[model samples]
Target: MIYINFNGSLHFKTDAIFTSQNRFAFGDGFIESFRVFNDKITFETLHENRIKASCEVLFLELEKFNLEEEVSKVLIANKLKNARVRIHFFRVGNGRYLPETNQCNFLVEAEDDNVQAFHLHTIETISLSKQYFKASHSLGNIKSSSALLFVLAAKEANKNTWNDAILLNENKAICEATSSNVFIRKSDGLLLTPPLNSGCVAGVMRQKVLQLLQQNSYQIYEQNFTVSELENAAEIFLTNATKGIQSVVKFNNKKLENNIAIELVSLLNKEIGL
Candidate 1:
């Protein structure tokens, strides 16, 4: 279920509707995040930065949208305290391949999300599918609406009873999961995540985790790694804005140690004051 606010006014929609000729309906849309905390929105700057970057990549105008104000209005009108809100921007006008106007229309959707952080307790996540095409360098990092690949992977995960599936890159390097960034804690106690070149989304939580790790002098590296490295790791975890740090207790039949994940989750929650 979703509560929607279109533009500035309170609006309700039975489902997301777009014209047949709309670029967004044709898979050309973008999504941004706004996390609500204590009746106020947090990480406005980060969200704005990401949105601006996405617009630049997609050639959309950012000057016409007032996202910050729209988010505040939606939260207040809906009487929400803590939640995960998504602002979806899409081209509304018609065109064969390109929209007549790049002008974007947005719909703000909010859902109840618990405030407490969580860690994954399940062991042995399934491998959904082999890597397909590489996400283009110009468009890879931004969370644009180009979601067919992710949608299919997520569907497979749900169907297979897997918590999440690991995605590989065109080169067969471990990229990320369906909706979260991947991390591995080495036997010697170092952390590693896929580099931007690996086609993983530059997740806000992933960025925050890297910052916190560096601030605390923990050894961290960003590079392309393979599934073999994952099987050899002492610990595995996933991170996103919604879930913070979730330990992947097992991948297939292998059980992973949670010692580092536990320590990091505690430290990260404190660092972010969650």
Candidate 2:
């Protein structure tokens, strides 16, 4: 039997914590996901800060609740040492489009994972998503539950038999991948990723990668670029909290390299003491 933590209380996964009235009516909530390594939550401080920012954006008050302790309790209850943990925070009261209360409730779920550390993996192929585009807005930076754009982009990728799809912003500039931040390396060894104004999620791993690159004195820039620029890249990588770095082997017919990505994985593991 699997157990989950709902608003600081333990219950079976089958238990219903919220009803239709108070549930996530319009997908009005946000999520935080991270990996737990050897019973420790990786990047705990970053995750917590992101959660706090997300709550503030949605006007949900945490009010002295201990998120880290709740997560630890869920991990202990599930007996999971290495796991993928997700926490969903939603407003508690309901009132059509506008919520009646700013108070929130959360559910924590943890599942066992096989990966013990960050590793480099190559995506065989990826393509630009043509069907949908992510809107460039402040809300786009939040990990909100309403992710239909990404969901549709993933479907488009699967339909084309591609490993993943690159999503463009409404302005037709590169934003991010289906579920990760996009990065490209030019032949001259310069790294480029879309800025927050380009409507990409403020990914924790993306932040860490930028810091790592700067610490190592690598040239990197966060600026908007076109598809033509991406096609000319010598290497392309996607980063998220769960998957450290994933290199794309092919984009359209262009072959890419993974040398930098592989090196970053080593640096990341060492920095995390993994």
Candidate 3:
């Protein structure tokens, strides 16, 4: 059974539902996705705060609805102990080029994702021939409804039988993966990820991992590095709220080590009390 909360109303998966064009496909909005583990929602408040911040950045006025409450209700109604949930928030009112009203609309969807343990899933990635998303774009950092660059990257990855694609910013600096933040463990034992200014989404798990590593006295830095630097990286890992940390075993044809990634995954699972 599947359940969706569309515009403050709940509907079963089989129910016929319709959303207006302005709110469905063409609108100013963003999405926040996280996992519910052991019947507890991970980083729930963090995701909510990010959502609110994104709305402010977009100048969107949201309609009446309690986001956390709605999410909880959906989980309870479906008896979901472990699930991956996505909340879509978009503008509701009219206009062709510009929306007459900026009131926001929300839709929530969840699927059972009973991941009881954290394991290192090594991924094979390929670097794109050209930069797709301009990290310097106005809405680049925000996970907006307009995700053409991400779509293109995914299509390219599928064509090449790759697990993910590496995206670069305007300056040809490493940015992030399509849906996950990229991290490179250096040969000298330092971890580096692109700074937020480099156009990477401020992911919930990324922040958590940063804090966890710092607490453990690990040397981690957020700075831009070139593709040449990546070629020499000792290890490459991806982080997201759902999968936690995934080690990139190979970037194109270069093999990467998983020693640090495995340790970090253990530390992270312990930090999250999973």
Candidate 4:
């Protein structure tokens, strides 16, 4: 498949410019991955809104980026009827580690789909007390450019031969996965998820699961709970835009039965009309 990069009205073959040195630099706008199914993006509208809000929070002009159309064009040009797309937004500058707020660069990557089952490991993450006033926000909730923290953690898990890593907030509570939301089911049949303020991403599937739970009258609660609670949970599953919902069969030697997870999976697949 062919790939294209958008810089003003200029377009380039992705390899002509997408060198390691270029992508590794700091403050190159933001990058997000999307899965395309049957030629349509998964949660297309929400993904669009998310990038737009994130760009705004980053203080970059949306029109200047012209992201949605450019990425769409790349998809069409590549004839990617179904694939994975990585859209990156950047505010370029002259040789500074810190990028300028202006001179944005938008990149579109259409790659083959890679869907696989995932296993999770509970990992520790130090959550710095975020203060928004005198400092610029990095669009944590909105999803933004800074991903080294998650990237490093995921790599750690992989080095240990695990599929993915689960991160905990400073409070020692379950936060989220390196790229998804965490779900826990207690012995009493309570479907528990950490609150958004508990340092977890409000993932698209997470939201959809909550709504499906409510519609189906599942006992879903949003509150802060400890890692110990997860240890005792009857079933554990992770959700995201890509992997969808994956059952955590084990976490740090804690073995779990996938029965309840199977039931929920069946229900979710039907409820979401997947």
1-274 per-residue lDDT for model 4 (tens digits): 3657566333546356554456336655676666676566666676777777666766666565544566667767777666777777776544566554454567677776544222233332212112111111234464456776677877777666666776777666677767778888898888899888776765766877787778878889988787678878887777776666677767666676566456655665564345
lDDT scores of the candidates, listed in order: 0.74, 0.89, 0.81, 0.64
The TM-scores, one per candidate, come to 0.88, 0.97, 0.92, 0.77
Order of all candidates by lDDT, from best down to worst?
Answer: 2, 3, 1, 4
Tally clashes: model 2. Answer: 0
Measure candidate 4: CA RMSD: 5.6
lDDT of 3 by residue, 187-237 (tens): 999889999889888888898889888998999999998898888999999
Candidate 4 least-lDDT 10 residues: 127-136
Better candidate number, 1 or 2, judged by lDDT: 2
- Give one digit per residue, the lDDT tens place, for model 2 in 192-247: 99999999999998988999999999999999999998999999999999888999
Give me the displacement of residue 106 in model 2, in angstroms: 0.9
Tell me the spans in candidate 3 whose CA falls farther than 4 Å from its real position: 63-65, 129-131
The global Cα lDDT (0 to 1) of model 4 is 0.64
Go through the candidates in order and give the C-alpha RMSD of each one to the true structure: 2.6, 1.1, 1.9, 5.6
